[model samples]
Target: MIVLLLGILVLAIGGCVCVVWADRGGPRWVRAVAAVTLAAGELLRIARRNRRRSIKRSSGGDE
Candidate 1:
């Protein structure tokens, strides 16, 4: 669980760095890769968070 969260965070920070680097006139390929990585990382994080939320909501009603 913690590992996943850390991986996601690391990817996210790396993604942002790529974007900044690309915006400053880095190679086209760099920019493309950064965008792709950023999107993938965000999607994974969102999915994980959403799954946790659903679990919490479902389990709490019994309390």
Candidate 2:
């Protein structure tokens, strides 16, 4: 489990580096990785918002 988490952390860090490099005109693959990373981040953000809303609703909280 720890190994899996470490792997994920490394991938996330690599993706962030790719994003910065792509902004400065890195290679095609780096740009591609950056795009995927951005999309994944967006999806996670949306999912988190939805989960929060659902939890709030379940607890009878008004948003």
Candidate 3:
């Protein structure tokens, strides 16, 4: 389990690096990895936002 978590952490760091490099005109593969990373980040952000909205509605918070 620890190894898996470490691997994920490393990958996330690498993805972030690729994103920066791609922005500065890195190779095609780097750009591809950056695109995937950005998409995944956006999806996760949207999912978390939706989850928060649902939780608020359930608890009777103002819409």
Ranking by lDDT: 2, 3, 1
- Give the TM-scores of the predictions, in the order they appear: 0.57, 0.95, 0.93
For model 2, how does the per-residue alpha-carbon lDDT over 15-60 read when each residue is reduced to its tens digit?
9999999999999999999999999999999999999999999999
Worst 10 residues of 1 by lDDT: 54-63
Q: Write the per-residue lDDT of candidate 1 for residues 1-63, one digit (tens) a residue.
A: 999999989977877888889889889887997889778878989999999889989899464
lDDT of 1: 0.86
Better of 1 and 3 by TM-score: 3
True lDDT of residue 53, candidate 1? 86
Number of the top lDDT candidate: 2
Clashes of each: 0, 0, 0
After superposing candidate 3 on the true structure, give the runs of residues whose Cα lies further than 4 Å from its correct spot.
Answer: none
Model 2 residue 46 CA deviation (Å) reads: 0.1
Query: Which portions of model 1 show Cα errors greater than 4 Å?
Result: 1-17, 61-63
The top-ranked prediction according to TM-score is: 2
